[model samples]
Target chain A: MCPAMGDVDIDSRTWRLLEPAGLTWRCWDDEYIVFHPWSGMTHYLDAIAGTVFELLLDHDATVRGLAAALANQADTPATDSLNVAVRQVLRRFDEIGLAEPIP
Target chain B: MQLGAVPESALRARFRATGVRLRLAGLCINLRTDVPAVIEQILQLYGGYPLEPGAGTDDARVHLKYASPLRRFIGRRTLVFVDGEPLYRPMLLRHAYLMIDSALDWCVSANVTNLVLHAAVAERGGLAVILPAPSGSGKSTICAALVTRGWRLLSDELAVFRAADGRLQSFALPITLKNESIALIRQWAPDAYISPVFTGTIRGDMAFLRPPTDSVTRAAETAEPALIVSPTYQVGAPLALQPLGKSEAFRLLTASGMNYYTTQRFGFDTVAGLVDSCPAWRLSYGTLEQAVDAIEDLLARVRMDPTASRPAITTT
Candidate 1:
């Protein structure tokens, strides 16, 4: 049986974008709109989610690493609240097939 | 020759016998009908449109005919057909004009090779403003008002965008006015020709406003898209115009497209390119005059500096 989502430690897992090459996207004013080729769906991402998606495009990262990077970009401290928010965004991305977690 | 130039007797006979082929925005539509009311309305409204030459083939063949005697006896019904296939169940005879108008709209929507959008389009000095909105959003009313103020009507129902070139083709058909808009437009432009109102129809009291002669004469012209505006009409509300974000504008456009999914990558690329080049805004107004003034101001601004109208993009 698959492990419960709560039991899987998000910080210990790394996430990556799904089929990065096939996805078409455009960014304007820090907002991003992406079109997935396989599902033929278009998605709109706000600044935070957009930053996360752009980061994942370069390489895989854990929840902690993404939070640190986001903090550096915003010039703020990487707090636990920011980590929680990043984890939530990753969960959403996974649900929408935009990103997946490595086992 | 224009349909109006055809003698009345010949027009009726052709409509009855062999179908009158009309050239509408680069499409050949062969319309056949025996119903007198439908024919009269077509002649009154489409009189300015040119007729196809030399018995050329048609892109869409539409027939609006009276129902069989049995069906008529049951309830004075009429049937609508496209390319030898019935499009809908028999409608009431009084609703024959609505049936034919909808059939012609279907012919344009189905037959076009370009990306079709459920939007109203108008142009000034070769720059087109696309208003992408759903029905009852005051798009048609705004479009008609713009026409009265000397802006050419590209289309009041569909915005046809060529995929290869990203230019908007003119589909200048009649502007449909609903309920209160009929009187509003009539008062606004007293000289404009309007059809008799069809009361108590499915859309509830609708009429067709004949397109201006100049617009019909320039049916071959295409315009570069310069602005995208999504309008909302609210009674007793002040005029409010706000710059729309590019991502939101892209969403609104793709949502308004009739064949976005079918067009796929082309649809995505076309809409993205529009968002990249054109400035988009959300406009809400109470009165026709206010909307017209605001749009004119926007047009002037865009005409002066197209790049200045786009919302400033800053990294967050």
Candidate 2:
């Protein structure tokens, strides 16, 4: 079985949806995606801060749980490379007005 | 009590008749008849004022004045009347409509060989600069200042290009200055035919400054595109130019162009050619005077060396 082909539910309150232009994305809120139709550009938010995002979308986990989730993501020596990558992506999202925090 | 196709000649004849006042945002307008109701409709959107009825002329023409929305058509022709005279609104609207409609048609009818840009353009010593920015970006204010500082005002707030020859067409509209910028230019250019103040717009009480008279009659002529700069009204800051890469410039230019996507084959090429042809930059600054000086220096540099590209300057 192809592991990538299977449905990977990281958590609740976080599900993946295909955007208007058919870009696959996982988000906690609508503001994470910026749709500039004229320029034909779509930007994703909270992508860099994957550790924090993954926890929230993972079964609607809370902030404290997110820190732990990030820590766990960091602990995996084999797959932990995604931790730094996730943080960078999240920073880029913030810089471009693609990310927002839930109040 | 009149209707039907109001052509220019008929309008000329009507201007020989009863004159009325049309007003918008405190500007008085004078127009001949045969102007459409659409122009009047636009003026009404601002604040329609009226002249003292029958003050137009001896032809029994209705002399009117009113406040006008500082507007430009991506077309040919420039019309300016006294600020806040309601008696001339209809005629003024008609004049604006005729000019705008014709210019728009000229751009489209000529085999898609022209691009009508919603920007302010001017040149000095044959070197030109086109300012393309979204509304409220202080483009008009800077252009007005440059023209007064001796730059030829090719256009006050639009950049029409005859793509057939890759030459820039000129416009006769006034330099539409808003808020503090309007007063600033008035103080800067003594020869500037400043109009009365207009207040209460979504963008603040905007006033327009008349561009050089030569620009009006020379609408058919075109200039080669040189520096493409975007201006921002960030007060109390020094003027600076920032680099604009082709890709980023294309994104912003296409975003700002009025009809880039409307003309199909030509639209794409026009935008592509422009981004490829001219060097673009982000000119961010607060005060109008500082921006004016920076643009003047850039213009001087462009004219002195036709091939010289102004170094990119960006202000934080």
Best by lDDT: 1
Writing each residue's lDDT as its tens digit, candidate 2 over A15-96 gives: 2222224222323232243333333444444433544444434454433344456656557432335534543443343344
Q: Rate the local accuracy (lDDT) of all candidates.
A: 0.88, 0.53
Rate residue A58 of model 1 by lDDT.
88
The residue pairs found clashing in candidate 1 are: none
The root-mean-square deviation over C-alpha atoms between each candidate and the true structure, in angstroms, is 3.4, 13.4
Q: Model 2 off-target regions past 4 Å?
A: A1-103, B1-113, B304-316
- Model 2 chain B lowest lDDT segment of ten: B57-66
Model 2: TM-score, first chain:
0.31
TM-score, candidate number 1: 0.90
Angstrom error at residue B123, model 1: 0.5
Give the proportion of true interface contacts each model preserves, from 0 to 1: 0.50, 0.00
lDDT of 2 at B194: 64
Q: Candidate 2 chain A: minimum summed lDDT over ten consecutive residues — where?
A: A1-10
- Model 2 residue B246 CA deviation (Å) reads 1.4
